[model samples]
Each structure stands twice: as C-alpha cells, then as structure tokens.
Target: MVARTTDTPVGRVKPCRLIGLEQHHDERGSLSIVESEWTTGFPIRRIYYLHNTRTGTARGAHAHRALEQLFVAAHGSFTVKVDDGHRQRAYRLDDPGTGLYVGPMVWRDITDFSDDSVCLVLASEHYDETDYYRDYAAFLEDVRRQP
Candidate 1:
C-alpha cells in the first residue's frame, strides 16, 4: 500500500533512486559510463571520491537543502543509508556499472566499506554550508515545512 502524509515523514518529497549504467566490453577491458541529465537525472557541478575509510567507520551524516548526488562504487563495495525523516532505506553499492541517486532534503551516510572500496560522488552543486542540514531534528523540521 502507498504511504500517506500521516504515515510518512516528508510525505510529499521524492524518494531516492537506484540507476544502472551502461557497460561496454570487447575483451580488452570494461567501461562503465554515466551521464548527467541522462542517467543521473541531474546536472553535475562537482565530483569527489572517497577512499581509505577505516573499517567500522562511517561518514556523510548530513542532508543537503538543494543538492543532488550520484554515488558509484568504482572499486569495491559499501552501504548507503538514506533517511527521509519519516522513513529509511539502505542500498549496497558493489558494482561500478550501477549508481545510487540521492536527492536533496534526504539524509544519507556511507558505511560498511570494503578494504578496497572507492566511492565516487557526482554532485549537482558546489559546496555551501548554508545548504546543509547536519542535525536530524532540523532536517525533519525543514522537510515538513516544504510544500
């Protein structure tokens, strides 16, 4: 059944998405490709990679006000947890040919990184401190205020 406003937090907001990429191989090697506005559904303005995360560690425990991101596991595997104030979802990223698309106003974090994991993030905007909601309560309040 579909969840309603009284049952779900951020009731009117769009949920995150999992997207597949194209993989081309011809015995030489393999290439995985993703394009902004095509696969990501958002234009990218910034790019970064995360690595060397110690075991049992986590990062990115915050939400953006108006930024979108696509995460690709270019090397190994990791888990991403997303919270929309009223609900939560988890995704395992283990393939370079796949990506998880996270929209704004959603809290997300990365954990369970394999020893060789390399996570690449393509962002829709540049960094801005005002665009971030680092506190869970504040994020919830903000999400509820949206129309």
Candidate 2:
C-alpha cells in the first residue's frame, strides 16, 4: 500500500518497531537497562525526556540527518509515526520497559499523548541543529535522494 503522511487514519506506515527490554523482577518492583552497541546498536551520548504535553497536541515532526534515537515511554502512552518516503508506520509507546528505535532519514512525528505520559529518548549523537530536517517536503526530498 502507498503510504501518505496524513493526520487521518488512511495511510499505511511501517513501524520502526519496539524492542522489549529485559525486566528483572523482585519484591521491590523491577529494574531494566539497555546496553549500547549490544541491545541498542548505538552508544547513547545524550538523553532527554518529554512530559506535560497537552492533549490533542503533537511533537517530533521532523527527521534527523545522522542521529539515531531510542524512545521509551516511562509512563502513560503516545503514538509515534515514521515515514521513509516509500512507506510509513505508527507505533504506540506505552510500556516503560519497551523502546522504539528510530534511525536516521526517517521522518517522525509523535502524537496522541496521554496526560501523564513521560517519553524518554536516548540519542546516539549530541544535539546538532544543522542535522535536523524540520520541513516535511525537504525530508521527502532527502529520502528520495537516498538509494
């Protein structure tokens, strides 16, 4: 199916997919950690989180040039969508122990956030404003130029 970037539920997108982390259980609750280059595939050099997002709002409507990110929902839930020019996918992040790995060249947008949601992001590179493609049309052009 041809994937069109739309706010409506009429597109077919491919999910970057979620990676389930190993959870250690105990009476005190649970613990989990991600190893860089092993489970994460990239060494995390930066960390950030998003919270207090109002309902019906969205975030991350762009793509990175070379940055890779792993997104985890530490609390509540949100829907993440990604487009690769040829295809698109949406992933629902709700489990804290699970992570969504987003690679470069993929246009992404995060929407449908719950009030109590806490989204944690582990990035492979340091912050670089020049690495971001903030325009959707530009992102598509970049993707199309890729082999």
Candidate 3:
C-alpha cells in the first residue's frame, strides 16, 4: 500500500487505497491489468492518459466537483500535488504499480514530469463540463460553502 500524508487532520484528505495492478512477466515482455470491476470501492467510469510532450509542462490546474480520480505514472515519473483548499501535499509517482487516489473537493496539479512520462487517470465519473472547477478562488468559495 502507498503511504498517506496530509498536512491537516487525516479526516480532510480521505485518501483511498492505491491498489497494485496484476502484472505478468514473461520472456516476451510484461503486462499489467487495471480492471474497473475489480476496484474495491470506487466505480470507474472514465479512463484517460496524459502525456506531456514538453519536458516541464504542467497540467491539472483545477479540481473536480463530484468526480474522484486515481492517477498513475504508467511510464517514467511525475509529481502530483493535491490540496483540499486548506492544506496541500505532493506525491511522487515513479512506480507503475502505484497510484494516488484523489478524492473529490481536492485541487490537483500534475507536474515535474521526466521525459517519456505518461500519466493514466481513472475517474469515477464520465466527463461532464459542469463538474470541473477551473478557478482556484471559485473552488475555495465552494469548499467554504460546503457543510
């Protein structure tokens, strides 16, 4: 299991398990599987991958309103910053088997990518333009209004 780190109380971040995918190694090569149905709790509905063509380019300057995400550095390495509108933490993802489960209400930024890095994101919901909060100020206000 991946380690959990939160600046504020642990109650705030609500990180779920970072499950290791099943890997098969053979003379030909290695293969890994990530099954949505096998997921313990979160039901994945969407899957996408982020490949940074530029070496230092960063992505994900916003947070999701209701979607939960699990990010994995399938190849190479990168850093993921997660903030709950109060405290923030950065996690380095270098292992293909490891992933970071980012719950809803957290602002996430993925950056510091090594060359050839590929980020695979598994989301609990399908793409909905209304579910995204692109502005930081608006995100903070929305979090404050939440009971």
lDDT of each: 0.83, 0.81, 0.77
Q: List candidate 3 segments past 4 Å from native.
A: 1-13, 26-28
lDDT of 3 by residue, 1-147 (tens): 223366343115465335677788899988877777575247889989988647778999998877888888899888887777777777888888777778878888888888899999999999998999999999999887766
Q: Which has the greatest TM-score?
A: 1
* Predicted structure 2: lDDT: 0.81
Please give the lDDT score at residue 19 for candidate 2. Answer: 78
The better-scoring model by lDDT among 2 and 3 is 2
Q: Which 10-residue span in candidate 3 carries the lowest summed lDDT?
A: 2-11
Model 3 residue 96 lDDT score = 85
Judged by TM-score relative to the true structure, which candidate is superior, 1 or 2? 1
Clashing pairs in 3: none
lDDT of 1 by residue, 1-147 (tens): 111223233313556777889889898999999887888888888999999989998999999988899989999999988888767777889989889888888998888899999999999999899999999898989887867
lDDT (tens digit, per residue) of candidate 2 on 74-110? 8899888887777777888888789988888788899
Error of 1 at 132 (Å): 0.5
Question: Residue 33 in candidate 2 has what lDDT?
Answer: 78
